[model samples]
Target: MKIGVLTIGAELLNGARIDTNSNWISKTVIDHGGMVEFNISTKDNQSSIIKALDFLLDQSIDMIIMTGGLGPTHDDITAKTLFEYFDDIPILDEKYWNFLVSRFKKKGFKVSALNKTLALKPSNGKIIDNPIGTARGLHFSSNKKEIIALPGVPSEMKSMMREATLPMIKKISQKSIHSSILRTTGITESSLYEKLFSLIKQAPDVELAFLPSLFGVDLRTSSTDNDKFSNFLMQVKILLDEFIYSDKNLELEEVVVNLLNNHNLTVATAESCTGGLIGDRITNTSGASKVFKGGIIAYSNEIKINQLGVKKETIQKFGAVSIETASEMAAGVQKLFSTDIGISSTGIAGPLGGNKDKPVGLVYIAISINGVTTVYKNNFKSNRKNNKRITSQVALNLVRKELLKF
Candidate 1:
């Protein structure tokens, strides 16, 4: 099945709001064995919407998934424009209008006249139910081409797509695009490509994609051939097992938490440059309390010395962002919280407060397990926010690697 996406909103074109709807629709379509032939965004005007629809039809796509401009407001002109494009008439859905009135009345509010627009549907179309919102999704088919119109609201669109749109596409989709995402950390995209290039060439049926972000690189291996897909995933595991944190798309923090749970151990954190971000990621996962004891934000030298028990002499000799201080902080947190594993991060995450010896984005991460402390030094080149975020990711990856040993 070949699909085209149309997102209609003035805010989308003017950069007031992002067109996340198109991206989500494309991904969902691709995941369910459909190909998104094109994605076009247009202003919330009848002329622009008509032009976009004409272009999508010209592409000869099997279906068009349109989002945005589906509401009670005057600018919400998708339904009216679509009816004109298809040369159809609006038919009021009396049953749905009564239901809406009853629903609003039960909530102690009267249904406004503007809301009646939601119950108006094209004469030649079928209504796609929206359980969460007042506006109903519309599906129109003519001359072997179909259009599925959904609300602009992300939550409402997602609910309708999952409940109705995807299942409808699945019935007619003859080709399945089999794909899997392999999550990895502590490796760069270029380096990972170099490692997997040979094997990738050997398997001509599989397509490998490198998606690199601030945290890590995600390896998306896809193949229409189901047999080849399984084999390619196995090859990736054998080659990049050390760097691969989760083959199931789980986050590094989730992986660390799972490992700690399996080993029946608890962990703690002592943070400086990254503040309490490391602890925040760990606790974001469900059941984190079982493995995460607590954390301390030792941002200042005074807090490091007083709260985490970092020796003042170590800070004086090696500086606060040095390996010695990081190691001491990790060990101090482990002892302070009586956890089996303790992690610490201390660095200069800044555009300022850096000098010749210690520049910006210079970070030191440490982990203490069973009284053995090991430190890692990393230099990242990015802004303050990214430096802090990447440092937190690195800290989590370090814990993941250590937990794997147990």
Candidate 2:
């Protein structure tokens, strides 16, 4: 099945809201053996919505799933635009309207007049249940083309897709597509591709994609053949052994946390320039309290000295962003928090605050285990925000690699 995704929101175009619906729908479609032909984002206007729909239809897509413009607000015009484009009339769903009234009444609130707009469904459409929200999802079909309209809210849209859309697509689709994501840090996308090029060339049936973000390079490969996919995965493990931290697309922090859990160990972090980013990542993982003791954000030299017990002399000699300071910070945190492992990130993330000897984006990540501290230096070339992100990623990877040894 060939599918297209349409995201309609002025907020998305204006950067007020990100259009995450397209990615979710596209991935869901691909997972259910449907090929995503195109993804288009448009402003929340009738003309633009209609035009984008027509453009997708021109591609002869079997289905087009649209998200956004399906609320009670005046700008929410997806249903009206869709009705006009399909030459359909809005049929009031009295059953749903009553249900909505009863739902609101249960919450000790009266249904407002604006809320009634959600009860209107296209005459040629089937109402998709929005169990979690007010906006009802709709599926319209004419001849060979089908259009599925979902809520713009991520949780609502995901629930509707999983409950209704995926099953529907599965029944109509013949092709089965499977994908795997191998996440690797401390390796550039180009370098990873070069290492895996020969293996990729040998597997003609599988498609390899290098997705790079601040976290790392995610090597995603999709294949119709189970054998080819399995072979590609095996070769990837062999080819990129040291760099491949995760075979299941787990984040660096999650991977490290799991390793720590398995080893029955706990960790703490002392952050300087990265400013508690490493701690934030670790605590984001579920059940992190089991392995994460706590963290100290020693952004200032005095805090590093008093809070994390970093020697003032080390900072004076080598600076806060140096390996010596980072190593001391890690060791200090390990001793302070009484953790089995300690990690620290100290760096210069800036467009300014750089000199001849110490430049911006100069990061030193240190991990202390069993009183032995190892520090890795990185000179990332990016703005402050990206430099922070890069430093955090490497810090987590360092923890991950160290935990792997045990």
lDDT of 1 at 145: 79
Stretches of candidate 2 off by over 4 Å are none
**Prediction-by-prediction clash tally:** 0, 0
> Can you write out model 2's per-residue Cα lDDT over 1-406, one digit (the tens) per residue?
8998999898999999888888778766777888788989999998899889878888877888899989999999998888887888898889989989999999999899898889997776788988789898988886588899998999999999999999989888888888888888888888997888888778999988888887778887888898888888888988888988888767788888889899999999998888888889889999798999999999999999999888889999988889899999999999999999998888889988888788887888899998999999888874998998888888887777777777
lDDT of 1 at 32: 82
Structural similarity to truth (TM-score) of each candidate: 0.96, 0.95
| Displacement of the residue 134 alpha carbon in candidate 2, Å | 0.7
Q: Model 1 Cα displacement at 116 (Å)?
A: 0.9
Total backbone collisions, model 2: 0
Q: Give Cα distance to truth, residue 105, candidate 2, Å.
A: 3.3
| Model 1 spans with C-alpha error above 4 angstroms | 106-108
- lDDT, candidate 2, at 367: 90
Best by TM-score: 1
